[model samples]
Target chain A: MNAPSANTLGANAISAYSISAAVPLETAAQLEETLRHIGATRYHSLHPFHKLLHGGKLNKGQVQAWALNRYYYQSTIPIKDAVVISRFRDRATRVEWRHRIEDHDGDTGAEGGIERWLKLTEGLGLDSAYVESTEGILPATRFAVEAYVHFVRDRTPLEAIASSLTELFAPNLHEERISGMLKHYNFVNPDIMSYFSRRLTQAPRDAGFALDYVKQHASTPAERRAVCNALIFKTNVLWVQLDALYHAYVDGHVPPGAFVPAK
Target chain B: MNAPSANTLGANAISAYSISAAVPLETAAQLEETLRHIGATRYHSLHPFHKLLHGGKLNKGQVQAWALNRYYYQSTIPIKDAVVISRFRDRATRVEWRHRIEDHDGDTGAEGGIERWLKLTEGLGLDSAYVESTEGILPATRFAVEAYVHFVRDRTPLEAIASSLTELFAPNLHEERISGMLKHYNFVNPDIMSYFSRRLTQAPRDAGFALDYVKQHASTPAERRAVCNALIFKTNVLWVQLDALYHAYVDGHVPPGAFVPAK
Candidate 1:
C-alpha cells in the first residue's frame, strides 16, 4: 500500500474504489492512521484546478462555472448532514453533526456557508435566484452530490460521519484557498471568502470528533475499513465536482446545456 | 430566441403561459403532425453527439461510456413505463405500455432489452453481473432516469405519456444505433443489436397511439402547451444523458468514483 500523504490521504491520490481491507487491527491508533491516510492522499483540495481557482488564475466565466457546479454540492450538504442527524441515537453525536448543518444552511439570512456561497456566486455576476434554483448546475454535479445524500440516508450513521472525515483535511484546504483566491482573482474579496473562513474553523473541530468516534467505535478490521472507505467515497464526491468543472470550464468547453458563464 | 431552429412557431402556437384553448377538434392527421413536430425539434435523437454516436464515429471508449451511462436510462425505462402504466384510466393504455415493460424486462431469463443491453456490455468487456447490478452507473444518469420515473409517478397521465414523447423520435435512433455499432465495432453482433431492432419496431407504434391521445384529449391551449412543454422537458432529460456521457466518455473524463471502463 502507498504511504499516505501528510500521514493521511490528501487530495492527489483518488481511487475509483477504495481498497477493501482484510487485516487484523493492531490498535486504534493504526486504524486512525489508516483513516487519516485516506484523507491525506485522497481529499479534494489537492485538485490542480482548485489551486487555479483559488489562486485567481481563472476568469469570471471560470469562477462562475466553479460556483455553479459547486452549488450542487452546496445545496445538498445540509441534506446529507440531516441524514446523519436522523440516524444518531446518541444525541451527543447528533448534537455534534447538527453544527455542520447549521454551518451550511445557516440561521436566518445570508449567514451560512450556503448563503456565503451565494455571495461568491453573486460576486461572479451570477443571479442569486438562479444559483439558489440550481437550474444551471452541471448534471454530473447534481448526480454526484445526490449520491452523497443517498449514502448518508442509506448507510449507518457512523459510516455517514466517517464519510465526512474528508473534513479532517479541510484546514489545509482553507489555508490554500484563502491565499490562492486572494492572489488569483480580482473579483474575490475577503467578505465573499467568509464561507471558507468559517468552514476552516468549523470543519477540523467537527472532523476531530468524528475521527475520534470512528477510531474508538469501529473495532474490527472490516468495520474500520468501511469507515476509511466512506471518506474515500466522500473524496470522490468532491473530486467528481472538479472533474465536471474542468471538463466544462478549463477545457474551454461546456456540455450542451450546462451553465454558460456570461459572455 | 434564435428563431427556434428553422421551425417557425406555428400561427397557432400558444403565445404565453396562459391556459391554451379547449381541446382542439382535430383529425388524426393533425395529431400526428403535432407529435412529429415535437420529435423533430425536441427528441434527444436530434442531439449532436447522439448523431455522432449512431453514425459509427464513436470510439470503443465512447461506446462503452454510452452503454455504461445509458444502462441507467435503459434500465429505468421499464420502471418509468410501469409508472405510466399504473396511471392508465383505461385498460387499453395500460395494456399498451405494459408491453413496453415486458419488452424491456422480458418474460424470463435472457430475453429483454435489459438483457440485450447486458450483451452489449459483455461485448464492451464489462462484467455482465456488475452491469446488471448497475452499481457503477453515473449519478447523473440515475437521477435523470429516476426523475423521469418520478415524473410519471407524480403527474397526470397525459403528462406521463407526454414524458414518453422521446419515443416519438426513437425509431430512427434505434436504426442509427444498430447500424452504427455494427459498422463501427467488431465486438457488436446481431444478438447485441436485438434491443435496437425491437425498439425500432415498438417506439413509433407506441408513440403513434400516445400522440393521437394527447392531441385529441388536450382540449385547451394550456393542456396542449403542457404536453408540448412536457415533451420539451423530456428532450432536455434525454439531452442531459448525452451531455453526461459526452463529458464522461467523449472527453475521457468520468465523474469522480463512477464506473471506469476496462480495456
Candidate 2:
C-alpha cells in the first residue's frame, strides 16, 4: 500500500475513508499517535473558513450565515450521539454515553448545548425560531450533517465512538474560537460564546473516555484501521460544513431559498 | 390561506415540502395546474447550471463535473423506485413499478440505463470504474439523492409516487440536452448520449402512470395539496443537485472530497 499522501484528505478525493497505508498491529501509543496525526492534518480547524471566521475577516452577515448553518449541526449532535448509544447493547456503555444527550439537551430546567448555540446565533442577529426550524441553512449543511448521523447509525459501534473522536481535537478549536471571536468580532461576547467555554471542559472529559474506549477496544490492526477511518470520516463531516459556508456566504453565492443576510 | 408566493420554490426554503397555503378543496384540473406550475418554476431545467450545461457554456471539465455528480442521482433512481415499490401493498402498483427497476438495472445480458449513463461519462473521458464507484461524487449529491430515497421510504405511498413527478418535466430537458450537447460539444455523440434519448420515452411513460396515480387517488383537498407538495419536494430535490454543481464547478468552490474535474 502507498503511504498516506497529503492529498488523502483533499476535499475531492473519495467518499469512504480508508487508511493511507496497510495496517500493522501497533502498541496503544502508536495507535493513539496515528489518530492524532489524522486530526492534525485533517481536522476542520485547518479549513480556510474557520480561519476567516476566527480571524474576524467576515462581516456580521457572513457570521450570521455561519451561525445559522451551524445551528443545524449543533441541533443534530444529540440525535447523532443517541444513535451512537443505540448501537451498543452494553448497559454501562449506554449509561456512560447517555449523558452526552444531556450534554446537548439538558435536564428539565437547565438549558443545554443546543440552547447555548441559540444564544450564539441570537447574539449574531439570527432569529431563534428560524435557527430552531433549520429552515434557512444551506442544503450542503443539511446533507453533510445528516451524513454524520447516518454514518454513526450505519457503521459498527466502535466506529461510531471513534467518529466522535473529532471531539479529541475540539478543545483546541473551541479555545481558539472563544478567544479569537471575542477579540475579533464586536458582536461576540462571553455569554453568546459560553458554549465553547463550557465545551473546553466537557469535550476533553468526553474525548478522554472515547479515546480510551477506542484504544482499548480496537483489538486487531484492522479494527484499529477502522477506528482511524471513522475519525477521518468525522473530520470530513466537520470540514465539509465549513466548505459549504465558505462557498455560499463568503463567495457570495447564497443558494436560492437559503437565509439571506440583510444588507 | 395566503396564495402560493413566487418564492415558495426558492432554493433555501424550509425542507419538508408543505403547501404555500392550506389546501382548499380543488377540482382535479386545479390540482393538476398546481403541479404543472411547480414544474415550470422549480424544475432543474430552469437552473442556471442546466442552461450553462445545455447551452455549452461550461468547459469540458465543468461538463465532466456535472456528469460525474449526476451519475450519483442516476444510479440511485432504481433504489428509490424500489423503495417506492416496497411502500405499495397493491399488486397492480408493484407490477407497474417493477418495470421501472428493470429499465434501469436491466435483465441478464441486457445493458441498462445505468450502463448508458456510464457511456456518457466514458465519452466525457471519466473512467467507468471511477464513475461506478461514485467515490468522487459531491456530498450534496449523495445527501440530496439519498434524501429522495428516505423521503420515499418515510412518506406515504402516494407521496412516494408524487415525488417521481419530476419525470413529468424530464423529457423536455432530455431533448434540450441531446440536441444542445451534440451541437455544442464535438466530444459528445449520439452513441454516447443514448441515455437521454432512451429517457425521452421512458420518462413520459413513467411520469404518466405516476401522474394518473396521484390524480386519481388524491380524493380530498388535503390529499390534492399533498400531491402538489410532493411535486414541489421532488423539484427541490432536483434543484439542489444543480445548485451544488453550480457552487462547486461554476463558482469554483469545490468542497473537499468531491470530484474535481481535470484541469
Candidate 3:
C-alpha cells in the first residue's frame, strides 16, 4: 500500500481492519517498533488541524471552538480509564490503572487534568459551566469521545490498555502545543496551558507503563496485532476529533446546533 | 427558544436539557402533542440531507453514499432492539419486544429487515461483504449508529423505548423515500426498496406499541419529560448521520478513510 499523507483525515489510512501484520514481528522490541511506527504515521499530531492550531492560523473563535469541542475528549479520559480498570481482574493491574483516573478526576480539593482543561477554555473566555456542560460542542466531538469510552468498555483488557498507548505519542504533541500556542496566540497563557505542561510528565509515565504492559503481555502474533490494532483505533479516535473540528470550524460548515462563536 | 426550522441540523433544536416542560402537560394527550411537536421540528425527516435524498437532488453516487452509510443504521436496529429487550424482565414485555428483533434479524429461514437492507446496498453495487463489514461507512455513521445502541443499553427502559418513537414518523418517510428514489434514480428499483416498503407496516405496529407503553408508563411529569428527551436524543442520533454524509459526500470533504464514491 502507498504511504498515507500525514494530513489524511480518514481512519481508513490506518484502519484496524487492514491486515498489516501478514508477517508479524517476532520480538517485543519489534512490536515496540511497530507501535512507535503507528504513532509516528497515524497520530493526531499529523492532522492538519494541529498544523493550523499550533501554527496559530486560527482566530480566537476558531481556537475557542477547538478547545470547547476538545473539552469533551479531555473530560472523558478518566471515565475511559475507569472502564479500562474495570476490564482487569488482577488487583495489581487495577491498582496501577486506577491512578490514571485519579490523575484526571483528582482527589478532593486537588485539581485534576479535567479541571485544568477547563482553565484553558476559561482562559479562552469560555464559560466553565458551559464548557463542562458539553452541550454546545460539535456532534462529531460527542461521537468520537463516546467512541473512545465505549472502546475501552467493550474491548479486551489488553486491547483497552493498548489503546492508551496513544499517550506514548502525547508528550511531544503536548510540548509542541504548549510552546506553539503560547508563542502564537496572545490569549493563551502559561497558567491556562498548565494542562499540557502537567501532562508532559504524566503522559510519559503512563505511556511507558502501557507500552511495557502491551509488549510483555501480547505474547502471540495475533495478540500483538490486536494490540497494534487497538493503538490504530485510538489514533483514529484522536484524528477524527481534529477532522471534525477542521470541517466545522476551518471549513466553516458548522452544523446548526453546535457552538457558534461570538462575532 | 426561537422556532427551529424544519431543517435545522442540530439536536439542540429540541434539546432535552432545554426545560421545554415549564408547565408539565396535564394529560397523555398533551404529552403526545409535545412528542409529535418534537418530531415535527427535530426529527431527521427534516434534515436537508433527507430532503436532498427524497427530493432527488443528489446524484447516483450521492444516493449510494446515503444507502451505504445508512446500512450501518439499518443493520444496528435489531441489536438496539435486543438491548431494549434485555432491559425488561417481564415475560409479556420481553415477548412483545423479541418480535422487533425477529422482524430485523428474522427466524431460521425467514427473511429479515437487515437482509432486505443488504439488497438495497447490493442493488447499489456495494459489495455485500464490504457493506456488512461496515468498513467503508463514515466514522460519523458508526458513531451515530453505535450511539443509538449504547443509548438503549445505558438509558432507563422507558427512555430506551421512547427512543424508538422516531418510528412514529417513519412510515411517512418510507413512503416518500420509496416513491422518490424509484422515480428519480434509475439505479434504484422496487426490489431494492423492499426494506422501506416493509417498514411501512412494521414501523406503525412498533411505534403504536412503544407510544402506548411510553404514555402508560410515563405517568409523572418528570418521567414524561424524560420520555420526550429520549426522542430528542434519538432524533439527534439520526440527524448527525446525515449531517456527516452531507459534509463528506455532498460538500466534497470526505475524510481520508471513508467510502469514496466511484468517479
Any runs in candidate 3 off by more than 4 Å, and if so which?
Answer: A1-13, A16-23, B1-13, B16-23
Write one digit per residue (lDDT tens) for candidate 1, span B139-214. Answer: 5676667667766777788888877777777877788778887887787888777778877878888887888788
Residue ranges of candidate 1 with Cα displaced over 4 Å: A1-18, A21-31, A88-90, A108-110, A216-229, B1-42, B79-97, B133-162, B208-237, B254-263
TM-score of each: 0.79, 0.91, 0.90
Question: What DockQ do the predictions score, one after another?
Answer: 0.23, 0.41, 0.38
**Model 1 residue B96 distance off true place after TM-score fit, in angstroms:** 4.8
lDDT of 3 at B187: 89
Which model, 1 or 2, shows the larger TM-score?
Answer: 2
> By DockQ thresholds, what CAPRI class is model 2?
acceptable
Model 2: lDDT of residue B43: 78
Against the unseen true structure, what C-alpha lDDT does each candidate score? 0.72, 0.82, 0.82
Cand. 2 TM to true fold = 0.91
Candidate 1 - chain A - TM: 0.90
- Per-residue lDDT of candidate 3, residues B1-263 (tens digit): 64333223244335423335353455687678778878887778888888899888998889889988888888788889889999998889999989998898878999999999989988998889988888778777887789889989998999999999999999988898999889988888999999999999999999999999999999887888888888878887887788788878887867545688898
**Model 3: how many Å of interface RMSD?**
2.7
Could you give the candidate ranking by TM-score, starting with the highest? 2, 3, 1
Error of 3 at B23 (Å): 5.7
